[model samples]
Target: MSNNTVVLRLARSDDLAQLSKIEQTCFSNDRLSKRSLKHWLSAKHALFLVATSSDAIVGYGLVWCLKGTRLARLYSLAVLPAYRGQGIAQVLLSELEQLTQSKGRAYLRLEVSALNHAAISLYKSLGYQVFGAYSDYYGDGSEALRMQKRVARYDGKGIRLQVPWYKQTTEFTCGPAALLMAMYSLDTKVALKQVDELAIWREATTIFMTSGHGGCHPVGLALSAIKRGFTAQVFLTQLSALFLDGVRSEEKKQVMCTVHDEFITQAHKLGCVLYEKPLELDQLYKLLKAGGRVLMLISTYRLDGKKAPHWVCVTAIDEHCVYVHDPDLDASQQAIDCQHVPIGLMEFSKMATFGKNRLRAAIAIEKLP
Candidate 1:
């Protein structure tokens, strides 16, 4: 194919011999063998991409899609020496990622020999970072640096959408500001005026602490805030039909059970931790009783029929109070002290509904480095 028309496509069984030839030529002793090729080409989650020039395979990359964990591993990538500067390798990688996203993989992880500057540079330019290292990882005893790219939003077409708020603000939706102070965390000059877009609410990250649901909206907003120079973790929670599916008298419990289990299972695979026990004010108060650091997610909804979504984060807990950053409340809004927040074990048990076992809450924590 012409350089302008270099087609990157999935490697097929018929192309195995050609791929093996390229591998052998590129990695003499370390090349993947025929047996390995058989396994990789046949595996369902295995991603195999080839860069073709005039219909001849010139480069290839392999990745593994681990859906339950939202992780994709780049096992090996190689390009022929003659095609080194033609950008065939880049084409292969882009197509491989497109394939990865198609399979619902979230993070793209890979190990590269520490000194392999070329490969490292390629990954870095593609937004990968060194997350860890594997000591003496290679058979030859060379250490491998583990690099990762949060791939939750990658599509062959690039980011799904450049959030309007993100374009207006220079920050991401998740960060010290989104977590610690909410929109008040942002500089006033850059914060967008409160507006409604397609039923989605918009406010300064600080405004999130103002109400329980404020925090829920900020999760996506937080992502927008820090879109530049950083990759933020995205945690989506929607209390749509799923949350209130069984509240109506005529609803079927069996359908709700099946849906709930599937949803929880998918969430856990996406790095979310499910809290089976309902969250009561006192239970949360107990967790914050010692003035210790606690990361908590709180939500409230109507038990009878109407279900409105609300969520908040517990930043600190002390003997007398639980300190929270409520985005719904403005920054000047007083810190909600647990004692006066109108939470009693009895009332909390009712409002939270965790005791009734009708609704579920979960949190996904992504530690920043």
Candidate 2:
């Protein structure tokens, strides 16, 4: 079959079986079942396009339009083996890109297995750039490369900052990873590696936050940044010791208290500024516009439905959404990965609180100007 003979159009309900077959034939793991294909076909803001040759399905591409943001996710793209090298995949991709662009989206992002050189080459040829990587993302232990391409144009009026993003190697190190993003944004000379990540975690961790070796407190993170020669300011909604609510044992409570007190003393000695108020979205916008980076504490429940306190860097802010560089990567769900993730302002506010204390913590770090 020639490329000119293939016809590309929106997938219909009748094409679900063929789409499922193509998915199974192209991918060994993470293949969408027939039921899943049906769901995607019926989902709101979903675009599933199929390429047909001789009135038979040869390839298909699926993309999702993110709510309240001008972004689209290319969920899957696959072409049958018999139809390889005829530009069928490229045609499907071009059609999908046009479809997404017509919908007013500015970017189209996707993930491909690192081993899929052909697919990666095709995406690169079509102007996609690899922005990040996920370790052991597939069910078969294969890593995935995250790539994106801009499908629409913008004037770039809002504060859109770009920072080096790193995912935490361990679940307890989100604080360190987020802080590293902030520090790196201010000082591009700073290297981001696992050694420095763990080292910073050791210096800042409060030994327990709800569970498991604790998380970093705002004061400790501020002190760590200041010690590294960056100006740091801590913002908190409450003046009390942090991470004290989840510790049931008196020994653990006392240990947390000791760590918190030590951080407070270090902050005072190091001249780190502390503000006794929650960092509002407007305040964060102003700070980013003024060329400062912020590390914020938020609940993971909003991103991946996990009820744990996490940290992310505020990289950009505009009228529609707040962009962040999340340190933890949820491979199963591409939306939560550490990249230019856009969260609605209202959703961000709900995700910024944690525990009964409704702890809202943020730290702004910047170079001394």
> What C-alpha RMSD separates each model from the true structure?
19.2, 5.5
Instruction: List model 1 lDDT by residue over 33-114, tens digit each.
Output: 8888878898877888788878898888899764222347787899889889877777777777767767755456778888
lDDT, candidates in the order shown: 0.49, 0.84
Write down the lDDT that model 2 would get.
Answer: 0.84
Candidate of highest TM-score: 2
Mark the regions of model 2 whose C-alpha exceeds 4 Å error after superposition: 1-17, 20-59, 64-72, 78-107, 111-156, 333-336
TM-score of each: 0.45, 0.73
Per-structure clash totals for the candidates:
37, 2
lDDT of 1: 0.49
